[model samples]
Target: MRLFLTFCAFFALVAVVFAWEKEDHEIFDLVSSIQASEGKDVNFYSWLEVSPSATTAEIAKAPFVQAYRKKSMQLHPDKNPHDKKIHERFARLGVVSTILRNKESRERYDFFYRNGVPVWRGTGYYYSRFRPGLGTAIVFLIIVTSGFQYAAQHVNSRRDLARIEDIVRQARQVAWGPRMVPVEGQRKVKVNLGGGPESEAPERWISMVVDANNVYFLHPDGDMELLDASTATQPAISSTWFIALVRSSYQSAFGRSNDLKEAEGVSPPQADDDELSGTASEAPGSGTVTPREGQTTSTSTGKRKKATKRR
Candidate 1:
């Protein structure tokens, strides 16, 4: 009876020791499981103990396959239920094997291994910067071409504004008897430096205009006085010169720029016209007259009020 009790005590003590070890394993959890895997930087190649550039077929050989199966089972969550990281590692190992075993995926992994990852997408968001295909290239070209066209139109519009402003400056000097004024309440004028579709009116086409005996420029933002014409003078602009300017603008818009030199003889020179009349004359039927460009032909011999009447 005493030997039997001693034997039972020994058996019970062994059971207690085994339970304690199982409890320790449960407490440590994934730590013990992590130790099962080798290497601090166990990439797929190192994990499988294969060449860095091993192909899918090579990796699928009997030896590699056996190693993969054994490792997978050892690190599986079921094998270490109390540990979580080993289960994760086991899952990760499967993914690594898949990537390294496929031709495309393997090439991608190789690239990442060789070169440093991009900082923008460094959080494991592996991606490729693919080249634009034929369709994409065509779309890009279309956008660029449209942008250039709009830019050209914009530039031409600005240039036309400047020239019209010069004419207005000259008009102001002639309208007010070549004198300068700085009064407020300056009104707006409308001038149409016409260059559009063929469907627009001719004489009614507005480019630049005058108000309050002052010459102001007209653009998208309405009338503005960029230069003071009260004292500053400009050469007289003839009907021919104005026509060439408009024609050049129109043709340039249509991708055909007319040479400005061709307009030289087409219009009477400002110097010659001045010598003949010594006063502003309307551009043909413009009806405004003064001592400068595009003035109304109004011979009204009065003070500042009558000046704006010059065509």
Candidate 2:
């Protein structure tokens, strides 16, 4: 029984030691994670050292202004174009001056510097006070990452919008239908219907016609039609260059029409091959089509379909 008691005591001691070690390791890990999150060392007092407690008016006085102007001019790309480091220094100086010149920004900056250590409560509140450095680091990382993500998204959005606009502009430029052909040795041009039925207008038509100058359309009856300011005109049978004239006239008229403005307001709908395939297999006049897997439909149908993931 004694031997068993001694053995039990030994195990109790070992268990206490293990618990203590585990707590210590956990604390250490928490500190390390916080430190890793904070970025490189930033001089906390650099702003205060550069801008002192002087009033904005005092800081902007003749001597300070002259010194800043001289330094900025020297660091300007036009002056030190070859020195990248100097350019960065110049930009930093400008930022410093701007902040110092603002009374509120300068006062807040000074408040943090005079305090023993500013406790940032924004993002690292979970870190223990004993690990203040880690907390500060966490906050810094959060701010930097958020700022970078925001800037990247903004830039990407602008690039995408510009690209979309360019594509739409190109599509508009080439929207006219097939070209018209002029009769040989005749001044007039004859538009070939190309076996299409008469009475059917071109697939596309200009609704708001303006002064004829920029665009023309081919009619089903083998004739090129042109819009004009005073009246619409068809080229005489002797006009061998009818197609070119029709195109120019249509361009001039449509270029200034309200159609372009309307087009600008309309956004292009998204197209997916799967949705299109499904629409093709849908029953006619069903009003709604559900596409099965591995299928899509064309754009001609009255119902527009988008690919939806099956549950």
Candidate 3:
């Protein structure tokens, strides 16, 4: 329930972060366009060609109005038809002018203008500057999820190790008695592996052999398995789901290629045997022949002799 509450709170915060108002969006757009066109360090006051301390009344007057008109006329799409960004600039000027003319919006802009605009403002901020491709998002998610899986694996490993230690301690206590003195011989004991005093279920018992410091679980078929840290499943990068999937895919492909190579390699040896049989039938004497230039020969009479060719 606590974890669920944490998740709910996290999502609530995310909703608040993305729930930008129309005025906030306008401010974001105005800041983005001015910074991109004019300069990174440019702000609302400089973009309007006015002092930072200018009052809303002063800004609503002719000086600020004239500055807005001047910039708008220069950047108007009709005036600069060849400029693809003129439309954006012209629209941005209108928003900036509107923001400075209104008492409420101008104060909002001034708050940021004094305190400085946030360098980052959630998804919108990143989308405006650094939009990721589909492949990039996939790779990023894989890395993030794989990292989380590895962390969970480590947590599980620690838990398993603790369980193993607890079982070992129980078995050792049965063998070594109250003092837990070192025992000379192996002692078999039954221990409650789970559902102890803390649990409502009946105590579950298992037979195990305790030899000095070593502990082993005894099976019904007279087989014993050692129980220790080594028995616990260890965490590793390869154990993570994504890495395991990739490794299995690679191994399957490699095994398939090897099987194909073996299948292809078998026919060549059969062909070579056929060629050797044909060569033997074409030999001069009634005997098996090897495909070598100089060797001993057994003729039809079964006499061994050196086979040679005369020019």
Candidate 4:
């Protein structure tokens, strides 16, 4: 529960950091358009020909109003129809003028003007400003999801390593006794991984061999496998669930195709063997023929000749 709360709090903080009000987005849109239409160094105050610290009262008065009207007339679409972005600039100008006209909106713009707008205003801001295509969105999702999966893998790998270390330590303690002094020869021992003496559930035991500085798994067949950093599963991009699943699926499909090809290749020889056996069974005989016990070979030949002459 505590961990869940911590994660929620973390996401909340991130959301807050990325959060921008609708009014703030309007200001951002205005700033981006003005810079894009005019020059990079031009700002809202300079574009409107007003002072950054100018009072709202001054902005509401004639001088500011006249300057805005003049700029609006110059950027209006009808006056410059050849300019494809003239209407956008004209609309952007109106938004800018409105922001300066209102005291609250003006203050918001002033703050950003002084400090400069943020370079990155989160994905929502960018998505609204420049709508990404499907391909770009998919690539973005893959990158984000893969990054999260990779981070989760690292967290799990650390946990698994800690558990493995604990098990190795327990095995070493059992083999070397209380002092845990380095033993010269390998000593085999069993470590209880789960279920205590008081628990009714069956205990899980792992047999291990301990030497002077190392612990090894003692297999049932008397083979020893060393336990170290390699014993724990490591974190990797390829090990992330999505990528791993894709790779495994591809391998499975390829393996099945190869198996089908092998089956096809092996069939022809078996079919040929079956055909040979069939032909042999269909044949009259394989050995030399002999006459019946009472008949001679010449008598049979004369009878076949007489029968042919009659035909």
lDDT of each: 0.56, 0.50, 0.82, 0.81
Question: Model 3: residues >4 Å from true position, as ranges?
Answer: 1-12, 32-41, 52-57, 68-95, 196-203, 220-223, 267-311
Point out the worst 10-residue segment of candidate 1 by lDDT. Answer: 120-129
lDDT of 3 by residue, 1-311 (tens): 99999999999879867866657766877887789898998887777688867787898788877888887778878989998888887877777778777889888877777777676566776575578999999999999999999899899999999999999998998899878887978999999977878999888899999987889999999899999999999989988888889999999999999999999878543457646643765547876555344667777799988756555
User: How much does candidate 3 score in TM-score?
Assistant: 0.69
- Order the candidates by lDDT, highest first — what do you get? 3, 4, 1, 2
Error at 281, model 3, angstroms? 6.1
lDDT of 1 at 3: 100
Deviation from native of the Cα of residue 49 in model 2, angstroms: 9.0
Error in Å for residue 295 of model 3: 36
Runs in model 1 lying further than 4 Å from the true structure: 1-42, 53-58, 61-70, 79-89, 99-192, 195-201, 205-311
CA-RMSD of model 3: 8.3
Top candidate (lDDT):
3
lDDT of 4 at 268: 45
lDDT of 3: 0.82
User: C-alpha displacement of 158 in model 3, angstroms?
Assistant: 1.9
Q: Model 4, 217: alpha-carbon shift in Å?
A: 1.9
The candidate with the higher lDDT, 1 or 3, is: 3
TM-score of 4: 0.69
